[model samples]
Target: MTAVGAAAEIDTYMLAMPSPDSPVVLPQWISRGNTHPNSRYQDPIWSMAPLIDNPGTGLVKLHWKNCPGPLLDQVKLAAWTMINGQLRPTYLQTRGVQARSRSGGTDMLATCHEWMRLARWLHERQITSLAACAETEWRAYANERLSQVSRDTAAIICVRLANLWAFDQLSARPSGIARPPWEAEGVDDFLPAVGTAGGGENATEPLDPRVLGPLLIWAIRFIDDFADDILAAWAERRRMVAVAAAAKAAPAGWAALEEWLLPMARAGHPLPANSGKSEIQVATTYIAALTGSNRGQVSRFVKQYGLAEIAAERPGPCPLRVPVTGRINGEPWREHVDFNEAAELMKHLGTAATIILLYLTGMRPQEVQGLRSGCCPDPAPTADGTDGRRLIHSHHYKNVTDDDGNHISAGEVRQVPWVAITPVVHAIRVLERMVPEGELLLSTAHHEFHSRHGHAGALKKHTLTLRIESFVNWVNREAGVQGLSDQTIPEDPQGAIGLGRFRRSLAWHIARRPGGLIALAIQYGHMRTVLDARTSSSYGARGRGGIHAILDVETALAAADTAARLRDRVAAGENVSGPAARRALTAAAHTPRFEGRIVPRTFARKASTFLARDGIVLYDNPDAFLICAFKHDNALCEPEPGATAPRQYDCRPGCGNTVRTDTHAHQLRERADELDQFAAHAPGPVSKRLHANASRLRETADTHDATAHSAEALT
Candidate 1:
C-alpha cells in the first residue's frame, strides 16, 4: 500500500494509539492506566484517553477512547488535520488547543469530552458528517441526551455540538464537502435555553441570628474558659498512650522502679466469666453507643477511655454534657466526653471560629477558610491615636482571573477590618492556636475520617458545610437542655445556612433593618463598603451582582415595605411631614403592595428604576423618618459618606432630605414636654432659650396633628 493510504488507514482505526515519540504529553494530573479512583472524571470510556498537550509547538491532541467504529472513521475523515508541525484535529485547534495552552488541562479535557459525546451521538444515528445535521436532528439529539442525564448536562452537550458544527463549517470542509444545513444559524440558536444549562439559584440565606447568636456565645465561652483544658487533656491522653506503647516495647527494666505503673497492663483484662461488668465498663459501652464508636476499644483503654472518669476528674465542670435523664437502650446515661473525643470538640471549635469570621467580618466563606495562622493581626492605632479594630489579612480567591480566564493560583490579598466584638477576636485567636503558624485555621485535623484526599490539614468546602449544620444542631440541643429555647437557632425550612450566605446576609440586614441594629451598626459600614466595591466591580452596575445583588434585593424589599407602611398610614389618616414625604405618599398610593418578603421580579425592576431617581432611599428611623435624596456634596449630615449610613443615624433636622412620620410626631411631643419642664425651673436667659426650643417642638407636633386631622376630615 502507498504511504499516504497507510497513514489514512492508521488515522481511521478506532483503537490505534499515538506513537511513543508523539509531541503531545498528557497533563500531570491526568491518570495514565485506569483513571485514579478519586478523580471526578468517572466516565470509564473517556478515562482511557488522557489529555495530551505539546508545549513545544503550542498544540494539543485528544484521541478518542472507546469510540464506536463508525464514529472514529467519521471524525478521522471529517476534521482531522496537521497544524504547526503537530498532528491534531481541526476541532481541537479551534477549542482544545486554546483551552489547554491558555487555560489548563481540565478545561481542555472537558471540551474534548463534550466533542466525544457529540461524535458518539452522530454515529449512533448513522450520520457521517456535520453537513447531515440540522436543527431538528440537533433537538432530537438533545432530547435523547436529556433523557439519560440532567438538563444542564444535555445543554452542555448541545452547546459543544453546536460549536463543533460551526467550526466544521468555517475550517474543516474540503473542496467537495457541502456546508452543514444549520451553517447560517449561530450556535446559540441550536443550544438549550440559556439558564437551563446551569445550576439553580445557590442557597444564599444567612444563618438566623437566633441560631448564630447562641452559637457565638457558646463558642466564645468554649474558647475563653474551656478550650485549653480540652487541648491539655488531649495532649495528656496522647502522652499516656505513648508511654504505654514504650512500656510494652521496653528494654526489659523500663518499669522496674515504678510498681504502680505495671498494673496498667492488667487493666485491659476481660471481665470475669460470671462477674457482672463494672459501672465504668457499662458507662463506656453507653458512650460508645451514643458516639457510634467501638465499645470494646472504649473499655480497654485507660488514659483516653472511661469518658465518665475523665469528666469526673477534670479540673473544672465539664462544658459538654448529656441530660441527667439521658438514656441509651433503656439504661440511664450521663454525658461525658473522653480526652480522645477532644478531636471532635476541636472540630466544633474550628467550625465556630469559621462562623465567627465569616459572619462577623462579612468575609466570604472562601476568605474565612483561606485564613492562615497569622491572618488576624493586632489592631494598629489610627492617626487620631485610638487603637483600631483588628484587621484580617487573607486572600480573596473568588472572581480573580488572569487575562485568559484562568484562575490565578494565589488570589489577591484583602485586608478587612475585623468586627470589634470580643467573641470574634477570641475565635480568631483560638483558631490560630488550633494549627501551627502558616497553616489554614479551619484545617481537617478534627474530622480526618470525613476527608478522602489526605486533606486532614486542609479544610474542604463540603466539610465546612457539614460542620455548620452540625454546629447548629449541637447549639440547638444545648440550648434546649439549658432551658434557653428562645436562644435556640431557628431551623430554616428553605435549606441549611451555606458559606456564601454570610456576606449577603450582612448586606441584607444592613440595608433593610430599621436604623440598623447596634450589633450590625458597629460592623456593617466597613463590610458594606468592601462588598459594594468588590461586587460592583465584578458584576457591572445593572447586573444582580454577588453580595451587592443581595443588597439590591433587600433594598427593594425595604422600599416596598416603606411604601406599604406609608400607604397604611395614609389610608388611616395619619400625618407625614415634609414635602418629599407627601410626594412619597402620593407615589405609594399608586404602587402595589408586596405580597410577601420577596419583591416580585417585575416590581423589583420597576422599584429599582423608581428609587434611582433623585438618589432617593428610605431610612426607617424610630425617632424620625428620613427620605434621603442622597446628594453627596449637599449632604448636611456629614462632609462625606462615612462608615455609618448618614441617613440612618446622622440625619439633620434642617437638611432638605429629612422627613417625619406620626412616630416622629410622638417623639417630638415627648421632647417638647421634657424641654417645657426644664424651662420652668431654669433662670431667665437659660429659661428663654429652653422655652424657644420647647415652642418649636410643640409647633412641629401640632403641625403633624393638624395634618392628620385634615386628612381624616377629607376622608
Candidate 2:
C-alpha cells in the first residue's frame, strides 16, 4: 500500500467501534462519577479520573500525545486489549481468550507508558510502523529495559510487549514482533522472581534507636500533654471562623466592637497584633474573632479607634490565657500557646499522633490513613467483666483475596480488628475530634471541609512523611525552649523516615524489648507481656499477614545481636556469673551474627526453629541489668507448658536462667547511684522507697562481684 493510503487506513482503524458484545456502550464513561467520557477511541488523551476511586493512586489521565503519530493507532489498540480485558471481558473471546484479569486505571496508565517507551525507541530509529519493527529489535528493547530496571519492572515491560503479539488479532495493524520471546518458556525463564516469600517479608528499615527514642518521646508528649491545648486552639479557631463568616452578612458596628474590647481593656491587655509587615499592626482577624465582625468592620474599627498605635505600644504575642499544662524536664514546656502559634502547632500535633499510632499499633500507613471516625469505639467490658482492650476497625487492601485466591480490588473490612494500645487509642480519640464522624482519620479536608474538594481523602503518604520530618525539625528548634536540648531526636543514619518504616520499627522494638523496661511499658501505657501476647495472637490474620513473619525474624536477629554482644564482653576479659552462664558462652560462640541484614521468609522460618532451642535463647535485659539465658524448664519466670521462651518481664530474683557480666554489674551500680541521688532529694516516704530499691541494686552488683568467674575459665 502507498504511505498516504496506509495513513488513511490507520486513522480509520483507530476510530473503530468497540466490540458489539462489549459490556460498555459507545462514548460511555469508564470511571465512576464520569458522566462524559473525556475521549473517544481515537483521542490522544484518555481521562481516567472517573475510573479511579482514590486520588492517591496518581495520574488520572493517559497521554498518548508523546507517541509518534503513525504508531498512535497501534498503541491505543493494544491498550484497548488490556482495557477490554478489565472492563469488557466478553470482548476478549474475539481474541481467542477467556475472561482475563487486567490492569485497572493506574496500571493501565503504566502499561500505556510502557508502550510509549517502545514507540519512542522505534521512532528514534525512524521506524514509523509497528509491523516494520522486527523480532530482533523487540528483543533488544526488552533486554535493554531488563538491564536498567528490577526483575519485577522488567517483567512488566516484557509482558506489555508480549501482549502486542499475544493479542494481535484484536489490533488492525499487528506488530512484526510476532511471537512471545523465549519460545516455550516465558519472561520468568530469563528474569528472576521479584520476592522469595509467599508470605511477604518486611524490607523497610526500622528507625535508628537514637531517632526512635526522642521521636517517640515527643510524640507521647504531644498526645498526653499538648493535646488539650492543641484541641482547644482548634475549637476556638473554628468558632472564630464561623462567627466571622456569619458576620460578613451582618456587620458589627463600633458600639458592638467597643463592647468586645471592654474585656481586654478590663484585663489590661493590648490588642492582638498582626506581624504581616515589619510594623506591629492591629490584626483584623483577631478583631473579627473578638467582636463577631467581618474583616471590613474590623478594619474600619481599627482605623477609627487608632488601635494600630496601641498594638505597636503593647506588641508581643496573643494573650488569650490558654493554660500551658504540658511539661518537659519537670518544667512547663511553654509559657503560652498563641492563636497563630497554635494554628501551626495543630498540624504538628496531628503528625505526632500519626507517629504514635503507626509506631505502636503495627498498622500500615494506609490502614491508619483509612481509619474513619468511630473506627475504634470505646472498649466495652469483657465477658469476664474486666476492661476490654481497644480495637481498631478498618479495611486493609493488601493481599485481600477472594475465595478463589484472586485479589479484591476494593478491600473488605478485616474480620479481626487490630488491638489498639493505649497510645493508639488516645491518638484515635484526638483524630476523631479533628474530623466529623464517619470521615477519614487523616483526611486533608480537616480544616477546609467547605471547599470545592470536599473531604479530600486521607493525607497522601508522601505528605505525611514530610509532615513527620517537619515535626522533627520543629522539635529540634524548640528543644532549647523546653529545656530538652539533650533529648532532641538525632538524625537517623538510615536517612529520611517513611510511613512503611513505622510498622517494621514497631515489630523490631517489641521483639527486642522483652525485658519490659518501665519506659517502654509507660510509653505504651500497658503491660509489656500483655502487649506481646495480644499482638502475637493476631499473627496470621487475614488483613495483617507479614507482621508475624517480621516479629519472628526480628526476635531471632535480636538474639543473634545479643549473643554477638555477649561474645565481645567475654573476649574483653569480663567475668560471667549465673547458673546459665556456660550456656550463654556456648550460644555466644555459635550464634551467627545477623547485623540487621535482609532475611528471606525461609530465614524467618529457620529463626523460629532457632528460638525453640531452649537453654541458649539469650535475651538481653538492659532494664534488669542482666541477660536471660532462657530455658523453659529452669525458668523462674512462669512459662506456659510447651512454651519455648521465658517471660523476661517476670524475672525472679533467684532465677537460674539469669546471667550477669561485669558490664551488667557496672550498669547495676550506676543505676543504684542514680537512685541514691534522687532519694537524697525525695520526700520522706518516697526517699525510703528509693533508698530500698538502691540497696537492692547495690546488693545484686556486690553479689556479682563476689561470685563472678572468668568466661574463659568456664569454657
Winning model by lDDT:
2
The C-alpha lDDT values of all candidates are 0.50, 0.70
Superposition TM-score, candidate 2 onto the true structure: 0.81
TM-scores for the candidates: 0.62, 0.81
Give the C-alpha lDDT of model 2: 0.70
Report the C-alpha lDDT of model 2 over 1-715, residue by residue, as the tens digit. Answer: 7554565476432223344233321333243443434455655567654454442343267777888887876777777655543323333353333223444566667777878888889888888888777767766776676677656566566666666665554444444445646534646755645553222335667888788888888898898888988877667766776666677625345567778764564466877875764777776666676766777877777777666777788764664456768777677776767766766688898899999888787767767777889998887798999987677887776655455333344456877777777777888898888888998888887833323365346777777889898899999988866667877988888889888888778767766665433246544324334433434445224422446556667777888888999999988899999888998999889898875475654676787788788898788877788888988888877766655556666678999899999999999989999999999999999999999999999999999999999986888
- Residues 1-715 of candidate 1 have per-residue lDDT tens digits of 7554555466542212233232233233233441322212212222212332111111123455645565554443222221101223443455432332122333345545665676677777787665566667766765565566544565455544544543333322222233333334533454445444243222245456555556556665566665665555555544444444333323233233123222432354232111124432233332332333343444444344343343333322222332233232354322454533555666676777777676666566666766678876887789999986565666665445455444333455653333335566788788777777887776665335323454323466676789888877877776677666766777664567777767656655666543444244534544445443433222112243334445555665666576677667766666666645644555556545666343333443464464454434454555343454344455575532322234344556666555566766877878878888998999999999998987888787777666543333333
Candidate RMSDs in Å, in order, are: 10.7, 6.2
Question: Can you tell me which runs of candidate 1 are displaced by over 4 Å?
Answer: 1-136, 143-233, 249-337, 409-424, 445-453, 514-521, 525-553, 568-574, 578-580, 586-615, 622-639, 642-715
